[model samples]
Target: MLDIKQIREATDFVRERLASRGGGEESLVDEVLELDERRRRLLAEVEALKAERNRVSKEIGRLLAEGKREEAEARKRETRSLGDRIAELDRQVGEVEAAREALMLRMPNLPHESVPVGRSAEENVVVRVFGEPARHAFGPKTHVELCERLGLVDFARAAKVSGSGFALYTGRGARLERALIQFMLDLHTREHGYTEVWPPLMVGPACLEGVGQFPKFKDQYYGVAEGDDPSNLGRLYLIPTAETVVANLHREEILREGDLPIRYCAYTPCFRGEAGAAGVGTRGLIRMHQFDKVELIQVVRPEDGYEAHEAMVRHAERVLQLLGLHYRVVLLCTGDLGFASAKTYDLEVWAPGQGTYLEVSSVSNCEEFQARRMRLRYKDCQGVNRHPHVLNGSGTALARLYVALVETYQQADGSVLIPEAVRPYFGEERITP
Candidate 1:
């Protein structure tokens, strides 16, 4: 959430920065300001009414003490009228405050100054490329073809059980998925200084709101209906990403300056509604209703936010580097950035069989945007409370990486060679039909 005070003080500057997004986000500045002004005016009126009510009450007491019962009754009647008016003003204040908050919640974070100005993914700038896509004399098979030939995934059965945009892994495919999850968890926890956490798959509305996922992208998530079970009767949503859970781990918390930077990684089966994306990249594992992901989250001092963001991007890149997958880092343009992120870097891995690069991860620095929403703060050395910056990135989404691995390591005989990094977890890794 943006600080309304900042918006009020620097309206033009805020609007200019948000204009780069080009979605009329700049126009929200005026709406928010108008609502805020109305709220303040209502609050001021309520305060004045309350002050008058207090003065009348004191006069009523004085009149009664002096045995002026009639005078006291008249003052009491006036006080009752003032009280009613104050109650009406208080209601108006509440309504205006709620409207202001709703508008603020819908507003996207302002892009960082360094973010490139562009209108779409086409304008995203590639920062670096790693390893060339593997070449083969024989044409590479798509993950779907390879998995089907090797009896690894059963898309047909998955469709029958859960409809399309879902996969049922069989035999080595299931084992490979498990191996990847363990490998990522171990890598992040052991080598990257991240604390591993296992969080709930379902969260309530406040949890989603705290992470800036509610009110704006609500349609993109699966919501759990209220059930007879007492514990489950509320507005619950299946987590779209582990970031939603891990980011709220410290919600409404105040930390010491020494603990300025807290890093956590979690593995979860993400669920997305994917509403309105019918037929776009729905084939294979590129897009799915249910997918596995390992997410990395960091809460750091404001000064260290950009540094932590860069480190997180490298941490995600390291997963690809260790697996020998060809990938590139892209700096997202303002228009292409996520709602909660001030800046983002997308890691796109080359898919030989698909003949394209698919996004495997997005690392973002949300600065204090999420922290403000979650009320996550830290006490500085001088004991002043301040909002900390929050950052999250996928160590990698398992489905796309699975696609890259299968296509990159497939042999002409239709067998798949597993990468050395995960061989120990897979036991004997050259999966053959």
Candidate 2:
């Protein structure tokens, strides 16, 4: 959630940045300001009424002590009316506050000033490219074709068992998935300075809200609603990413100034309701309702956020680098930035068979947007509590990374050669037909 005070103080600035997001978001700031004014006005009225009631009660007491019974009764009646007025104003204040909060929750974070102003992915700027897309003497086979010929993933049965947008890996495929997860987790924790955490896959609504996933993107998640379900967590939602859980580890917390930067890496089976674009090139591991991902999270001092963002981009890029995959880092413009992120960088790996660059990870700097929602604060050197900047990235999402790996390494013999970096973890050099 954005700081209301920021909007109140910098209305035009916030509106202009939000306008760059291209959603008529300037109007949202106006609404928030209007509601804020009403809420404050109501609160002021309630305070005045309360004060008047107190003064009247004191006068009533004095009148009774002076034996002016009639005067005391009149003042006592005035106090009653003042109390009733205060109650009504208090109720109005609560309603207005709720309306303001709802709007705040729905508002996207203001785009960082440095972000390029654009309208979509087409306008995203490619910051750097690593290696070139390969050419195959024999026509390249898609990951789907590769998986089928090699008997790796059982997509047909995944549909039978759980319907579409799901996959069940067998033998080498399952092993490969596990190896990728372990590889990324180890890389992030052992080298990237991130602490490993295993958070609950199912989380409460507040957890989703704290991470800016609720109210707006609720349709993209799986959940158990409130009722007599007999579940320990009556109302719960399965996390869409480990970021959703790991970032909340310090939710509603106040940290020491020395612990300015907190890094965490977690591996989780993320469940989603929305599959990606439909039809061609969307088959196989390119899009799945349930997929494995190793997520990276960092909370740092406000000033260090951009530095952390750059380092996070490097960390994610290293994974693809070690795997020897050809990929590019694209800096997202304001229009393409995630809801909670002030800025983001997407890593797209070239899938020769798929004949496209598949996004394998998105490293985002959310600034203090999420910390404000989570009420996560850290005491500064001045002993002032302030929201710390938060960052999250897919150390890499596995499905498409899996697709890129197989499609890029497929041999004419209908087998997939495991990348050398993952060879030891996969326990084999190739998945032979």
Candidate 3:
């Protein structure tokens, strides 16, 4: 959520930045301002009525003490009218505040000044390339073909057991997934200085709202129906990413300035509807309703936000570097930015078999957008409370990462050589047929 004071003071600047997003939220400024004005006006009226009622009560007490029964009753009637009026104004204030908050919640974050002025992913700029895609001795097979030939994943049975967008890894495939998770978790915790957390797979709607997911992407997640959960958490929904839960671990918290930067990493199964995307790139593991990902989040001082952004991106890039994968980092254009992110960088890994680049992670700096919603703040040197900035990224999504890994390392003789970094965890991981 944006600071209402900022919007009131710098309406033009907010409008211009939101315009760059090309999401049609620039007009929201006027509506928000109107509601804000109404809320303030109503609150003022309520306060005035309360003050008047206080004076009238004093007068009524004075009249009753003076043995003037008729005057006291008449003053009491005036007080009752004032009370009724105040109550109505209070209700109106509540409604206006709710409306204003709803509008603000729907508005996407203002783009950072450094973000490119573009309209789509096509306009995104490539920041850096790691290495060229590896050359193959034979016609490379797609991840689907390799998985089938190696008896790694059972797509047919997965479809039968669940639905079309699920995968059941068998034998070495399951082992590889576990190895990748452990490897990423260890890398983030030990070297990247992140605290490992095991978060619940389901979260309340407020958690999603705090992360800028609810009331917009609400339909994209799976919810546990009323009776499905024994605990009955009021229709809790499956987390779309570990960030949905991990980033809000400090919701409604106040931290000391010394603890300005806090890092966390979590591995979780992400669930999404992927609505209407079946016609796009639903090939193999490219898009799935359920997928595994190691998510990272950082809470830092406002001035250190961009620096943390760069560091978090590096933390994600290190995973690919250790895996010996060819990949590139791309800066997202304004229109391509996520709803909660002021700026974003996507890590695209090369897949030899697919002959295309697939996004494995997105690192972003939200710049207090999420912190404001979470009511997460810290005390500064000046003894003032201020919201902190939030940075988040995927250490890597195991599904697409898996696709790139298998397709990149497929041998001419039909075996898949595991990357040396995960060899210790995978335990002789040349998944031979």
Candidate 4:
């Protein structure tokens, strides 16, 4: 959410941002300003009427005490009228405020100045590329092919159980997933200063609203009904990101000044309904309805969010660097950025089998957009309450990273060489069936 004062004063700045997004450019700003104006005016009017009613009620009490019965009755009648008017205006104010908030929630975050101006990922500039994609002397195998031959994954059975875009890991595949989770958690908690947390996979609508996922990605989530009524189902949704839970842990609470920067990391299986996508490219574990991810979230002072964002990106890079994976970092163009992210950096890993780079993680700085919606705040040294800046990034996505690992480390004998980092977990240097 943007500061109301900033929206009013920086209307042109916000307008430019919406324009760059390529659609819905002209109407949103004007509609928001109009609704806000009406809300403020109604509130002022209602406050004045309440004040008048209070004054008259007291006068009526004094009049009755002085034995002025007729005057007191007249005052009572006037107070009753004021009460009715106040009630009507109160309802109007509520409606206007609700309308204003609806508009505000849909407004996208302002892009950072450094973000490239473009319409799609094709326009995104690669800031840096690491080691080259591993070369194969023979025909390279895709993740699906490698997993099937190695008895690591069962897709046909998974589809029978839960439809497409789901995978059933077997044998070493299950162990590999667990090993990756442990590897990432250990790295972040021990070396990165992030506290490990286990958060709920199912969350309430209010929590989604805080993270800017409710309105934007509603269709993509799996909503669960909350109410007991047969007709009026109370709905809940599976989390699409652990940040939705981590960022809202301190919602509506005021943290002490000493805890200026709170960092958290969690391993959770994210669920997303890739509704419209189907067929070839999404083959294998690349586009799954369920996938495990280790997420990193930080709550910091507003002034330090940008610096913190860069540091978080480095933490993500550290994971790839340690695993000996070849990848590249790209700055997401403004038009290609997520709705809530003012700026984003995507890390793409080279997949030899696919013959292309696949995105493995995205790190973003949301500034105060998420904190404002979550009502997350902290008390500064001066005893001032203010919203803390929030940032979240995928330290690494398990499934996509596996695509890079299997293809890059494949040997002539069909054995997979486990990275030195993961060797301790498997109790062997290579995965052989």
Candidate 5:
């Protein structure tokens, strides 16, 4: 959540910043200012009424002490009327404040000044590229074809068991998925200095709101049915990513200065409604309603946020480097930034079989945007409590990464060669169907 004080103090500045990101609202700032002004005015009126009521009460006491019963009764009646008016003004103040909060919650975080100015993914700037994409003498088969030939994934059965946008891994395919999960988890926890966590797959509305996924993106999530359990009653959604759970670990918390930078990695089966994402990358593992992901989250001091963000991108890139996959990093432009991210970098891996690069991870610097919503704060050395900056990235999403691996390592004989880094986990260097 944005600081309302900042918006109120520098309305024009906020307006211009939002406009640069193609988020121009002609009267958004004006509405906020008007609501705030009304709230303040109502509060002042209530205070004045309370003061007058108190004064009248004192006068009533004086009249009663002097044995002037009728005068005291009149003053008492005036105090009651004053109290009623104050209650009405207080109600108006509450309404105005609620409206302001709703608008603030809907507003996207302002892009950092350093973010590139662009209107779409096409305008994203490529910052770096890794090893060259592998070439094959024979035409490389797509992951779907390879999976079918190898008896690895059964899309037909998956559709029968669940529906389309799902995959049923059989034999070596299941093994590969498990190996990749363990390999990525080990890489993040052992080598990348992240604490591993296994969080609940379901979270409540406040958890989603803390991560900026509720209210706006509610339709993109799967909600749990309300049953007899009272605790589970309200809005509950399956986690879209482990980031939603891990980033909220410190929600409503105040950490010490020594705990400035906290890193956590979690692997979870993510569920997305994919409400409007019907035909885009629907084939194979590129897009799915249920997919596995290893997510990375960092909470750092404000001064260290940008640095942590860069380090996080490097951390995600390292996984691809170890796997020997050709990938490139693209800095997301202002218009492409996520709702809660001030800046972001997407890591796209080359899918030779698919003839295009697919996004495998997105590292973002949310700064204090999420922290403010979560009320995640830390006490500085001077004992001043301030919102900490939050960052989240895919150590790499598994489905597409799995597709890239399968296509990149397929042999002419239809066997898949495992990457050296994950060889031990797979217990074999090559997977021969």
Candidate 6:
């Protein structure tokens, strides 16, 4: 939520920003300001009325003590009417304040001044490209084709069990997925200074709200089935991302100043409904109902979050770089960015068989958006408490990373060369039947 006072003070600045985000009424800003003014004025009026009532009550007390019944009676009657008026105004003030807050929450965070002004992902500027897309002398096999031929992935059985878009990674395929998870967790925890934390795979609605996912993306997430209830309305849902849980670890609590920058990493199987998605793009592990991912989350001082966000992007990119996969870094445009993120950097890996760049990671700097909702704060040296900035990035998404690995490294003989970083865990260089 925005500070109403700042919204009032920076109306023009806010207007320009809302315009850049696309169509929205500029009057919405005016509305917030107008309601804010009314709310503040009513508050002051109520305070004044309360003060008058207090003064009158004291005067009445004095009158009664002196046995001046008539004066005391008059003062008491006057305050009775004032009390009724205060109650009426108080009701109005509450209603107006509630409306103002609803509007404030609907408002998007103002884009950073340095952010590029663009409409869609097509307009996103590539900051850098790393490694070259590998080439196959013969027709390259897609991960699905390669996985099927090698008896590695079992989509036919997965479909019978769950439906399309889900795959059963058997033997080496499963081991490869586990290996990648271990590799990422090890790198992030040992070398990159992140603490390993295993958070709940199932979390409540409040946790989703902390990451600004509930109200906007309720459709995209999977809610837990309510037992014996006709409507599947329940208190909890399968977590869509570790971000939902890890970011809210300190929700509603104040952290010690010494723990200013907290880093946490977790491996969890994420579940998503993907309600309206379809077609070739949504096939295989690229989009799934359930997939495993190693998530990296950080809570940092406001001054350090942007730098931390950059480091997070590099960390995600390093995973692909180590795997010898070509990828590019994209700075998301306003439309392409997530709801809570003020800025987002996406890592798209080259999928040779698919002949496209598949987004394998998104590192976002949410600033204080999630913190405000979670009430996660830290006290500074001056004894001032403020929301700590939060950031989360996929250390790597194992499923899609597996897609890139299978497709890019597949040989004409139908074997996959495991990356050196994951080989120690997988126990071999070649995944052959």
lDDT of 3 by residue, 1-433 (tens): 9999999999999999999999899999999999999999998888888999999999998999999999999989999999989988888999999999999999989999999999999999999999889899899999999999999899888888887789999998999999999999999999999999999998999999999998888778887877656676546899999999999999999999899799999999999887767532344888998999999999999999999999999999999999999999999999999999999999999999999999999999999999999999999999999999999999999799999999999999999999999999999968898
Steric collisions counted per model:
0, 0, 0, 6, 0, 0
| Cα lDDT, model 3, residue 174 | 96
Residue 133 local lDDT, model 5:
91
TM-score (C-alpha, index-matched) for candidate 4: 0.96
Worst 10 residues of 2 by lDDT: 275-284
Candidate 4 residue-wise lDDT, 5-77, digit = tens: 7878998988888778765643588888998888889889989999999999999999999999999999999
Model 2 agreement with the true structure over 1-433: per-residue lDDT tens digits = 9999999998889989998988776788888999999998888888888888888888998999999999999998888888888888888888999999999999999999889999988989999999988777799999988888788899888888888788899988999999999999899988988889998999889989998988888878887765756564438888889988899999999999799789999999999888344742345787788899999999999999999999999999999999999999999998888899999999999999989999999999999999999999999989899999999999999899999999999888888889999998999999998
How far off is residue 356 in model 3, in Å? 0.7
Candidate 3: C-alpha lDDT: 0.93
Best by lDDT: 3
Instruction: State TM-scores per candidate.
Output: 0.96, 0.95, 0.96, 0.96, 0.96, 0.94
Residue 335 miss distance in model 6 (angstroms) = 2.6
Q: In model 5, what is the error at residue 239, expressed in angstroms?
A: 0.9
Weakest 10 consecutive residues of candidate 3 by summed lDDT: 274-283
The lDDT, on a scale of 0 to 1, for candidate 6 is: 0.86
**lDDT for each residue of candidate 1 in 1-433, tens digit (9 for 90 to 100):** 9989899999998899788898888888999999999988888888888888899899999999999999999999999999899888888888988888888998888999999999999999999999999998899989999999989899999888898889999988999999999999999999999999999999988888988889788888887876566566446889999999999999999999899689999999999888899663355888999999999999999999999999999999999999999999999999999888999999999999999998999999999999999999999999999999999999999799999999999998889999999999998769887
For model 1, the stretches where C-alpha displacement exceeds 4 angstroms are 226-234, 278-282
Please give the range of 10 consecutive residues that has the lowest summed lDDT in model 4: 226-235
Clashing pairs in 3: none
Better of 3 and 6 by lDDT: 3
lDDT of each: 0.92, 0.90, 0.93, 0.88, 0.90, 0.86
- Clashing pairs in model 2? none
